[model samples]
Target: MSNLIPDPISNVFKSLAIAVSLLVSLVAAPPAQALEPIPVPIDIEALDITSSIDLHREAGNRLQVSTAPGADGIVRRIEVPSRDGTNTNWAVFSLANTSDEQIDRLIVAPNYKLVGSALFWPDLGSSRIAAITPSQGIAPERQKSLEADVFLVTLDPGSIVTFVAELTTPNLPEIRIWEPDVYEETINAYTLYRGIILGISGLLALFLTILFVVKGTVMFPATAALAWSVLAYLCIDFGFWGMVFKLEGGGSQLARACAEVMLAASLIIFLYAYLNLNRWNIHYSHLALTTLILILGLLGVAVWDPSIAAGIARLALAVIGILGFVTIAVLAFQHYDRAILLIPTWCLLIAWLIGAGMTVTGYIANDIVQPALGGGLVLIVLLIGFTVMQHAFAGGAIAQGLISDIERKALALTGAGDIIWDWDIDRDRIYTGNEVEDLLNLKRGSLEGPARDWLDVLHPQDRDRFRATLDAVIDQRRGKVMQTFRLRSEDGHFRWFRLRARPIIGSDGEVIRCVGTLLDVTEERTAEERLLHDAVHDNLTGLPNRELFVDRLRTSVVRSKAEETAKPTILVLNLDRFKQVNDSIGLSAGDSILLTVARRLGRLIGQQDTLGRLSGDQYGLVLLSEQEPDRIVALADSLRKAVRAPITFGDREIFLTCSVGIAFF
Candidate 1:
């Protein structure tokens, strides 16, 4: 180290060091200090009043409104109607606006029923009018403007009144209100969008239906068709789109009614096509027929001159919609395929159903009955479209690829399939995909338990073997094995499966995990058994024929010779008059005699002895040393006598006999 500099240089250097240290401290301390009072912008969403009120129109009077200036000489236009025919006379308009810095108290409105009450506060909702319905009170020093609907009598025979309210913001924040017209326009836009969507989805559904019918797409088309029908039903609001436009009057209401009828008809058609409700689905067809009948009745009522028909139709449509909803739910639950839809599906269903109900109720209550499921429909269609796209491109989309794999696996094992699972003895948990539940008909809620407990599902005969095999696999530590065994399906049906698994080893060459897949082998096993039967047995008679008989004879002889060094008695047999039986009674009768003779021979043989068909009507038996050939001959004679007795096939009797041949080794 060098010596310190003189006073001026040392002082300057010390100051610089202190300055650097202070700067560094300032920089380092800021982030922590600043984090102390973190600013969090909480998004706020508030709900307020929205009700449809009829504004009655007066003819030859243009509806008008005016407001007197305040004490501060501030006079703004209070809302008034542009003179259209309606029952709504006036309405009080209010909005809320506040800065984070200050608490703003809003003094607003006598929200009471008044004749000629209509206000124009389209600005109120646009400003996100956070309205607090304050009681009649004195105005505060810093008061906000309170707008109300007013009517100025004017020159028209049939003029409708609309109230306009405005909150003129003077350098203050603004919030919006849910304006009726704006909402209407928005809903109309959404409905239009829904129309376009319906067009595309309808075409898509039609295409799929045709393709699936031609291609025999099995289950996928049905699921896809149902999904499409749901989309259309939701967009159509079960036909409530008709009522909203009908509010404009003239042919509009009729158009709305016709639209409803068409939608209902279309809905029935969709159900018919989608569910194939015509032929085998008798119950669904009946239900659908009833729904169509109701639709016809509703249509008749709606067209029964003037408004009463419409009212009745509206009510009927609501009822029909509810019924259809129940039907759809039952079908979906039964199918449970793509059946288990997420929230959007429920939202769409409820929106249309609710809209239908509201249209009916609103009509009876004499309120402005615009009961279209507009926004909700928009939300559903967009979501459903997105969902469809996501599903269609599932394999390509990274986020959805994994999900689709799981879904497909679950779907594949949905019915009439077996799921065989294996667990590593070392690993505490079992590994199987979602397919396990579908295969086993298990609720996701019911799948957890000890691994060995699953042994209960195995057939009693196979359980011991299964357990032994598992133990062996575990003991061996790193072997791959494929095993066939019997297990119980969810429906209590027994099924065979072939399961295979292997252990994944760690870097230390120790088995860390095990993985496996299961395949249902019941059909294959049955086919294999059939092949074995075909190969070994005579087709006409149910007996162990030559190949198997000879094999059994050789096995018994070898076993007998090696074990006790005893001579095994062998009795060879032939039907004594089989040729005569065949010539007299025909081959079918001869077959019956052979069957009867085989049964007799089986009864005559002891439990330990073996018997088999040697060839044609010839047979053989192997007995232990204790059994004699003479007794076997007697047994063969008894079989011949039994065959000589009356044999029945259809309505005929026949007689037959077999020649006995004896041998000893």
Candidate 2:
């Protein structure tokens, strides 16, 4: 009992000795090896400090400094897991400087497009946080001029400092530690590559705009809009917009979201027109239009909340991809050649979208994602540009060939003494070949004026008719036109012309011009008149034949009955012994004697009377006079006396007698 109850001073001394031993043991242990000091100018990837780093997830967006070390959450691998938007990710790491000189380094979060804000805190310095964002104002501690979240870290020689990084981002953060030279080199390379892409995109947009102006096609403008939208997105993503416009807080993010939404909307519009959906499938076209409207509606949401709008934009992009694929498939099934050509391009675009989406959603690392996306964008542009140009210019090529062919044909026609004329209805101008002046026997350049000048050259009798025919052709949109009119030559002679024209219809299905050939038909008209005259007259004798005589008698009879005017009489005279004369003498001599008898009979009738040759030896007369019975007998006797006169035919005397029969109407 006396041993158990020890003395108070000895017990106190023993406890002190034990505490001193424990303290001495702790002091002698060499600080647990001080976590291998990181050398200066180190490669973050080679060092692979992620395994030794610690991560702490906070529940809210607010920044909170924790005095406790992040021992509970240590990252065991190089890959950093993604976090949701509701939480903040804090990465804790030790940056120990084992070098002889003080070293300054940059800790960069390269995925600036995804990161909202990044805060850096070093335990060695005054308890202060250096925060950086894409839209932050410039400061010495943060590299705001760059498009990345960059912070400067300085470490003294033989110093080990623990750092905490507060990252507010949905995607997995990529942190890189680099010396100034290496970072500058990397940034320069990135800038060069991005600049090339943006330049190409801008040029493409301008080209598409020019195409729209020239072609006046909906697809061209839609493609131009899409290209411009893509350019805007690239500008925003590459930090060019930030330099130009100081968009703070959510402004930059909202603009990016709106650009994405516009891009999707423009893409839909372009696809609609490019695929000719309205002409092919009306219902599908309506659906695409509705989808476009919805995509545009996302802008409103983007104005209110960019993150939500960005998510919707991604969804819209996915929907558009599906819709485009289905549309192309449907068109391909219908044997649309353009849709078939777009299949591989669309597939490539879909693959690129999937890869980009994965990168954005943190499923994939961002190390190669940005460059790949940029390269993929350029490739898609080239592929689509090639495809569109192949089809768009194909029709133009065909039309150019056709125009050349037409020009060749027109030249041949002009060489053949025909005039090729183009009537511009819109301007009311007439363009004729140079040969027109020579053909019309007019001064040079006489017909190079307005359409009225062309009309002035036409005969008065034909001008109105020609105008009417042209107007009808234009109004009715007739494919072919044929008209015969007379044009006045410089000699004041009217010459007939035959116009053969074809209407040149525009894309709007209106007749814009009439292209035709003018062929002079004056000789043809003269020959036709001669042939008509020959049909009515006798060949040997310059007198009307029996058919003409009958036609005149019918007309006279109808006039006499209708008007109760002077009556008409018809006299048929037959030459006696004509066949005997033809047998005695030759046929030529008989013909000569008949001509002499016809001349004698022509002197006996009045000017109003018509004398016609009835047969080889017979003659008929239609007298439009009031004749009584005795007058008729007298006329018949006079005709007989005229025929009874003897005539000399080729040194032979020929005598012929005529028997006359008269009829009255």
Candidate 3:
């Protein structure tokens, strides 16, 4: 029983050991041969011939077919492992033409910037080969087609041939098999599409550049830079640069890298300026500046070392992506109109960048990303253009409003005697209507020069004041000016002119021009002065009224107190029998007698003293000089005598006696 149990246990251990050994052998074995035979479709015009293909990455350009490895379950578009530019990618696939006739096809690698490619046909036999090199150009065996690199392949009926494509490019390539006519048609459509995109982008760039020159706004130049950078990148991507410059493979790659770096840097710059982060938030602005500096530094590094430029550009895109989203959020929070407008476009751009980066890094295939990139770019451009146009339209509306205002003012100032003038501050030139010279009574073209010439025609007292008002308008960059000054006419008389000016500010907030009307106010000033004089004087007697006398007395008292001088003396005098004289004579005779008394008193008082008609038959006098008590009494007696001696009203000799009262402060 013990022997039988041991035998069964030994058999079980042997079975387990054999199973472990088989599993180890299978795990340690090399990958299966990838050269699977793929049947060519006899019915289809074009075929996505990459499903059975195998991709293997090998270091260095000198790859041997014997050492090529295999991969399985590949799709129409496959992402091969990427390495430095020195590495070679091999795609192995076998094609069997099952038809009775021979099939001619084109093997296409749809990348414009492909560095170099080679094809080994007839079951990977190097004897039959087609190759293309960057320096020597295309070989006879390879076809020169549109933007994509092309290779010729022929399949015989009932024959199976494995093909190996050796690709040496920075990124992995997407391979396709196509008929000649279909490829030509596809290329034609692609060219047209790319042409439209490039044309629109170019026009947008030019428009923004013109705006920058015309308006001098920060956002214009920034957007222009971004537009130009995008255009350059598209040029490189679409193979236009290659056709124009005919650069070598390395040089072309370097140019592409530089273009990409510039694109990212320009995007960062545009966002910083477009969002107005510098003015809105201090900390974010600093962060943006720092990021910009880093990007510029990367650009410098790319110039110095082109091999790592793509990596640098990717890094820049990533950095900007994070910072840009944060800034957009902040702007949206603040309810910035432009930032709100930019949201959808900015999101599309970020998505494209991410997808493109993934495609380049082999996280995704090129086929999916390429189409999205094209459509996204166009959409982003359209949306950004729309947003920028809002600013342009807003500026145009403001300018139009200013023009309407100027037109209205001009219409209002088109009166027969009004003189309209415009001062070009920068050129120091003054332009005026012909009426200015006629109004000033000067010769023709007398005031048709610089602003200083106009100033020379002004009265000496008004010249400095007018200049000061104009300077203030230009310096402060605010407010309109309404100054009333005197301008000297040719006849040596100064006429008062009222100047009403409104300054026109440029984009930089500087007063570029001043427009105004010069209206003659000489008659108005004369009327005003006459009215002022009549307000303080008695009409019948033509002497200072009681209000004027009181004002003068108050001023004299304050001056005496301030200067510690003698206080002014006041005397009130009344004519005796004045009411009896008015009652006997007519009212007209009474008025004439009062006028005669006022003239007599005016001749008695000095210019420094005040003489006034206080009321009917009453007079008041103020002496502003220091006088002894006897002198004061003598002055009061003189005033009384002057009023009492008035006579000869009409045909009668009116006589009067006066009583006087004196007061001292």
Top-scoring candidate (TM-score): 2
TM-score of each: 0.41, 0.50, 0.49
By the lDDT metric, which is better: model 2 or model 3?
2
- All candidates' lDDT scores? 0.50, 0.71, 0.70
TM-score of 2: 0.50
Off by over 4 Å in 1: 1-448, 451-479, 487-495, 504-512, 576-580, 623-636, 648-652
Q: Per-residue alpha-carbon lDDT of model 3 for 1-665, expressed as tens digits?
A: 35455778889999999999999987985534445567777677677765656665554454333311222233222222323335465555666677888877777766442122211100100111124221111321577643556777777776666555555543334567787788788778778877887888888889878867766667778888988888887887777787788754556667767786788888888898777777776986787778777777766665666546656676677778766877787788889887788888888888877766665554665443554575566567667767876887775423432345666665556635578778888898887867767877888888777877877888887888888988899888989999998878888888888888899999988899998777888899999988988899888887788899899999999999999886789888888887888889978888888888888877877778888888888888897653677888887777777766648766777778888888888
* Ten-residue region with minimum lDDT total, candidate 1: 33-42
Across 221-320, the per-residue lDDT of candidate 1 in tens digits comes to: 5434444644544443323333344222224334444444545555455445433445446777777777768766655655554244444444454555
Q: What lDDT does model 3 reach?
A: 0.70
Deviation from native of the Cα of residue 241 in model 2, angstroms: 1.0
Query: Any runs in candidate 2 off by more than 4 Å, and if so which?
Result: 1-52, 59-90, 98-102, 111-140, 166-172, 361-366, 390-392, 396-665
Model 2 agreement with the true structure over 1-665: per-residue lDDT tens digits: 47565589889989999999999987974333222334554444223343555555553454322222213332221222223334465555666666667777776655353322211110001111234221111222666543556677776666555555555543333555778777788778988988998999889888878776766667677778878888888887777887788764466777777877887888888788778788866797778878888889989987887667767777778778887998899889989898998999999989988887676665766455766686687677667767767756887422332245666776578568777778888897887767667877888788876767767888888888888888898889975779898878888988888889999999998999998888878899999988988899887677899899999999988988999887989899998877888898878877777777788889988888899998999999998753787887888898898777778666766667878888876
Pairs in clash, predicted candidate 3: none
Q: Output the worst ten-in-a-row residue range by lDDT, candidate 3.
A: 118-127
